[model samples]
Target: MNLNLRAAILHNVSDNDQSQLEDTIVDAIQSGEEKMLPGLGVLFEVIWKNSSEDEKKEMLETLEKGVKG
Candidate 1:
Protein backbone atom coordinates (compact mmCIF):
# COMPACT_ATOMS: atom_id res chain seq x y z
CA MET A 1 0.00 0.00 0.00
CA ASN A 2 1.19 3.46 -0.90
CA LEU A 3 0.21 6.21 1.49
CA ASN A 4 1.32 9.83 1.66
CA LEU A 5 0.97 10.67 5.31
CA ARG A 6 1.66 14.38 5.06
CA ALA A 7 -0.95 14.82 2.39
CA ALA A 8 -3.39 12.70 4.30
CA ILE A 9 -2.92 14.76 7.44
CA LEU A 10 -3.37 18.02 5.57
CA HIS A 11 -6.45 16.75 3.82
CA ASN A 12 -8.01 15.71 7.09
CA VAL A 13 -7.64 19.18 8.55
CA SER A 14 -8.10 21.29 5.46
CA ASP A 15 -11.54 22.46 6.49
CA ASN A 16 -10.79 23.02 10.16
CA ASP A 17 -11.25 26.46 11.59
CA GLN A 18 -8.88 28.00 14.13
CA SER A 19 -10.74 26.60 17.11
CA GLN A 20 -10.96 23.14 15.67
CA LEU A 21 -7.27 23.14 14.83
CA GLU A 22 -6.42 24.22 18.36
CA ASP A 23 -8.62 21.49 19.81
CA THR A 24 -7.06 18.88 17.54
CA ILE A 25 -3.58 19.88 18.62
CA VAL A 26 -4.49 19.88 22.28
CA ASP A 27 -6.23 16.54 22.03
CA ALA A 28 -3.32 14.94 20.22
CA ILE A 29 -0.77 16.16 22.76
CA GLN A 30 -2.91 15.23 25.72
CA SER A 31 -3.49 11.75 24.37
CA GLY A 32 0.25 11.00 24.50
CA GLU A 33 -0.18 8.17 22.09
CA GLU A 34 2.75 7.14 19.89
CA LYS A 35 0.52 7.19 16.84
CA MET A 36 -0.06 10.90 17.26
CA LEU A 37 3.63 11.76 17.03
CA PRO A 38 3.85 11.49 13.28
CA GLY A 39 0.86 13.79 12.82
CA LEU A 40 2.44 16.29 15.19
CA GLY A 41 5.73 16.00 13.37
CA VAL A 42 4.00 16.66 10.09
CA LEU A 43 2.32 19.73 11.56
CA PHE A 44 5.68 20.92 12.83
CA GLU A 45 7.22 20.35 9.44
CA VAL A 46 4.57 22.58 7.86
CA ILE A 47 5.09 25.22 10.49
CA TRP A 48 8.86 25.11 10.10
CA LYS A 49 8.67 25.39 6.37
CA ASN A 50 6.34 28.39 6.49
CA SER A 51 8.01 30.23 9.38
CA SER A 52 10.20 33.27 9.03
CA GLU A 53 13.82 33.17 10.14
CA ASP A 54 13.01 35.05 13.35
CA GLU A 55 10.09 32.76 14.03
CA LYS A 56 12.31 29.73 13.53
CA LYS A 57 14.88 31.19 15.90
CA GLU A 58 12.20 31.76 18.50
CA MET A 59 10.97 28.21 18.11
CA LEU A 60 14.51 26.90 18.57
CA GLU A 61 14.96 29.02 21.67
CA THR A 62 11.68 27.76 23.08
CA LEU A 63 12.66 24.20 22.25
CA GLU A 64 16.01 24.67 24.01
CA LYS A 65 14.27 25.99 27.09
CA GLY A 66 11.78 23.15 27.00
CA VAL A 67 14.56 20.59 26.81
CA LYS A 68 16.41 22.22 29.69
CA GLY A 69 13.26 22.67 31.74
Candidate 2:
Protein backbone atom coordinates (compact mmCIF):
# COMPACT_ATOMS: atom_id res chain seq x y z
CA MET A 1 0.00 0.00 0.00
CA ASN A 2 1.21 3.48 -0.86
CA LEU A 3 0.80 5.78 2.12
CA ASN A 4 1.44 9.42 1.44
CA LEU A 5 1.68 10.43 5.07
CA ARG A 6 2.73 14.04 4.59
CA ALA A 7 -0.01 14.73 2.13
CA ALA A 8 -2.49 12.89 4.27
CA ILE A 9 -1.58 14.87 7.36
CA LEU A 10 -1.74 18.19 5.53
CA HIS A 11 -5.05 17.38 3.94
CA ASN A 12 -6.51 16.38 7.28
CA VAL A 13 -5.73 19.76 8.81
CA SER A 14 -5.91 22.03 5.78
CA ASP A 15 -9.31 23.37 6.76
CA ASN A 16 -8.48 23.89 10.42
CA ASP A 17 -8.44 27.34 11.96
CA GLN A 18 -5.44 28.55 13.97
CA SER A 19 -6.93 27.57 17.32
CA GLN A 20 -7.83 24.13 16.06
CA LEU A 21 -4.36 23.72 14.68
CA GLU A 22 -2.92 24.76 18.06
CA ASP A 23 -5.08 22.23 19.81
CA THR A 24 -3.99 19.51 17.42
CA ILE A 25 -0.35 20.29 18.10
CA VAL A 26 -0.88 20.39 21.84
CA ASP A 27 -2.75 17.13 21.81
CA ALA A 28 -0.08 15.44 19.74
CA ILE A 29 2.67 16.62 22.05
CA GLN A 30 0.81 15.70 25.20
CA SER A 31 0.03 12.26 23.88
CA GLY A 32 3.78 11.45 23.45
CA GLU A 33 3.09 8.56 21.19
CA GLU A 34 5.52 7.52 18.43
CA LYS A 35 2.79 7.56 15.83
CA MET A 36 2.30 11.30 16.27
CA LEU A 37 5.92 12.10 15.38
CA PRO A 38 5.42 11.69 11.66
CA GLY A 39 2.51 14.13 11.66
CA LEU A 40 4.51 16.64 13.67
CA GLY A 41 7.41 16.23 11.26
CA VAL A 42 5.11 16.91 8.33
CA LEU A 43 3.85 20.05 10.04
CA PHE A 44 7.45 21.16 10.69
CA GLU A 45 8.32 20.61 7.05
CA VAL A 46 5.49 22.91 6.01
CA ILE A 47 6.64 25.54 8.50
CA TRP A 48 10.25 25.23 7.31
CA LYS A 49 9.30 25.59 3.67
CA ASN A 50 7.33 28.77 4.34
CA SER A 51 9.58 30.33 6.98
CA SER A 52 11.98 33.21 6.50
CA GLU A 53 15.65 32.53 7.25
CA ASP A 54 15.35 34.39 10.53
CA GLU A 55 12.34 32.36 11.47
CA LYS A 56 14.18 29.18 10.67
CA LYS A 57 17.06 30.32 12.83
CA GLU A 58 14.70 31.08 15.68
CA MET A 59 13.07 27.70 15.31
CA LEU A 60 16.45 25.98 15.41
CA GLU A 61 17.40 27.97 18.47
CA THR A 62 14.18 26.99 20.17
CA LEU A 63 14.73 23.38 19.17
CA GLU A 64 18.24 23.54 20.57
CA LYS A 65 16.87 24.73 23.89
CA GLY A 66 14.26 22.06 23.84
CA VAL A 67 16.85 19.36 23.25
CA LYS A 68 19.06 20.69 26.01
CA GLY A 69 16.19 20.54 28.44
Give the number of the best model, judged by lDDT: 2
Q: Candidate 1, 47: how far from true, in Å?
A: 0.9
lDDT of 1 by residue, 1-69 (tens): 999998999999989999998898999999999999999898889889999999999999999999999
Model 2 / residue 5 / CA error / Å: 0.8
Task: Give the per-residue lDDT digits (tens) of candidate 2, residues 1-69.
Answer: 998988999999999999999999999999999999999999889899999999999999999999999
- Candidate 2 CA-lDDT value: 0.95
Clashes of each: 0, 0
List ranges where model 1 is wrong by over 4 Å.
none
Which parts of model 2 have CA positions greater than 4 angstroms off? none
Displacement of residue 30 (Cα, Å) in model 1 is 0.4
Q: After superposition, how far is residue 17 of candidate 1 from its true place, in Å?
A: 1.1
